[model samples]
Target: MNRNIKFDNLRGFSMILIVMGHFIGTTHFTQTYFDFAYTLIYLFDLPLLIFISGYFSKDNPESSIKAFRTIFIPYLIFNTFWIIFIYLTKGYVPADMYLVPGFGLWYLLSLYLWRAFLPTATKIKHIFVISFILAMLIGTVNIDPNFLSISRTLCYFPIFLFGFYFKNLEEKFTIKRSYALLILIPLLIGATLLYLPFNSTILILKYAYASLHMGNLKGMVLRLLFILISMIIIILLNNIMPSKKTFLTKIGKNSMSVYILQFYFVFTIPDIMNYLGFNYVFNSTFLCIFYVIIATALVCFILSRDKVNKIMDILIIRVTKILMKKTTP
Candidate 1:
């Protein structure tokens, strides 16, 4: 029906999938199964997040400025904190890496860029098709991934554009939700049968095709396929999902917190689980799957709490506000 709950549910669920993806990759499980499971989750998780974000995107200067204050500032803070954290904990000198994004924080920068540029981008004719072409062709270049997050910015921009366009598309056309499932079911089955070689890094989208040792033409084809599939999955799931307030609703509402804090869990949770006898107990693939889900749910629950969100808002958003106010000219 007419409710935000559906979007929140999707966001919450996708966010959990994001965390579970991290868990399954790192936690000891049958290597074969984990790879497949990770591949399956990643096929659409980040796309879903991007789509949902674009669904709410505004084409205005005010919102763009706000994105800088809210998102870019936090991104900078996150990078700085990580630099310090790594040096202190691992004795790694991340020299002159200030402009680079750290791990999950790239999404923050991407979002800021989208807010800033997508408004102007929307003015271009056939921007959607152009975005797809750019997303595919950009991988053939020799640009570094972290240099202003350039590669990923181009790679994922199509999905972001689709998200922004979908809102208007739906308003004008009556979409048949049933048809989406008809296609999605067979689409998933065939994809699963293919069992493409996937890892967390590929989904992160920071590497060039050359970096991954993939032929440029072949990599472009694969990128196109993945983008198409992700678009389908994002559309179908949003249409089919129940629009009701539930466990995931709260998490969705606070999904940003879960996203930002998840790296902490991703890196440490496996070790903690191992020390607490997780790896010793969950031997089978299914059992490890169960454990990872439970662990991710618990972490999501904790991070979704109001207190945690407020503290993060203070650390990220509030701090940004303070900085912005001081620098306002």
Candidate 2:
């Protein structure tokens, strides 16, 4: 398959925001600037990630099995590690956290499901409508938390479908970089203005919440709004970013390793810094900027290493070969 550098750039952009957003979320201080920054990052991070995932999705048995090996195996392995770490450190085991996806591991599970569902989903006419209806209907019900990951899987199915269709959409309506700035300026300002009243509500909706006491209809309405807004941002981002190889492109190329492994530092580093009595160091917004830069660089450096990628490749290959054998004639 030909490499789509724009998609890689998009993933690189989203992955950085994901890491930064996680760091900011776990930090102790809260500022209006931080809140606004966090909201902007939150708005498109997952949607962009999922959209790119769908854009690259291939429908075939080999690709399906590869997705299982690459995403699901690592998800299970890392989740087990997370559970053990929590038990050893916190002195209590949240069994549910392991059995279900805790932290950001849900995306990996969701990606596997989306790829698996694609064959059947794409064959139907009006899939966009069907998927949206299913997502909205699913939003109305209170799914068990143990099954929350699957709820998100269902909730964002439409976005995935849209990404799949974006392949067609891009051919007809390519937004040039010259128009990107013009379009983005108004959208960002409007989104910011709207965010004042709806910040927390938007956050709740972004997570595909079953209910936030807004009742089912309103909750569904908010989610739909979020979906629309996220798509617009995704489009703008695709237009704005350079479609060439760059530092981020390298990071984006190895985004899976960074995505799966970065949480280690995201969750733990603050504690480590605090334990080292570096609270004063992390207090300033300037310092936080520095931290974000360093943290992102460190994550990219570690995950992009040859040894680490090789190890991951070995495990993914081993698992896929076994599973493929079982299913093959």
> lDDT of each model, Cα atoms only?
0.80, 0.76
lDDT of 2 by residue, 1-329 (tens): 77788788888888888888888777755767777777777777888889999988887666666777777777777787778878877898775875588578888888988987788777889888988787777666666634548677877787888788888788565678879779987786677556555645444333444445566777677777777888888888778889778878866777887787788888888889989988875689888877877887788778766577678778777766765555547
Candidate 1 Cα errors over 4 Å, as ranges:
1-3, 28-30, 171-179, 195-202, 274-287, 326-329
Clash totals in order: 0, 0
- Residue 21 deviation, candidate 1, in Å? 0.6
Q: What does the lDDT come to for candidate 1? A: 0.80
Question: Highest lDDT: which candidate?
Answer: 1
- Measured with C-alpha atoms, the lDDT of residue 309 in candidate 1 is 87
Q: Give the TM-scores of the predictions, in the order they appear.
A: 0.89, 0.89
**What are the per-residue Cα lDDT tens digits for candidate 1 across 206-257?**
6888887889987788778888888878877876777878888989999888
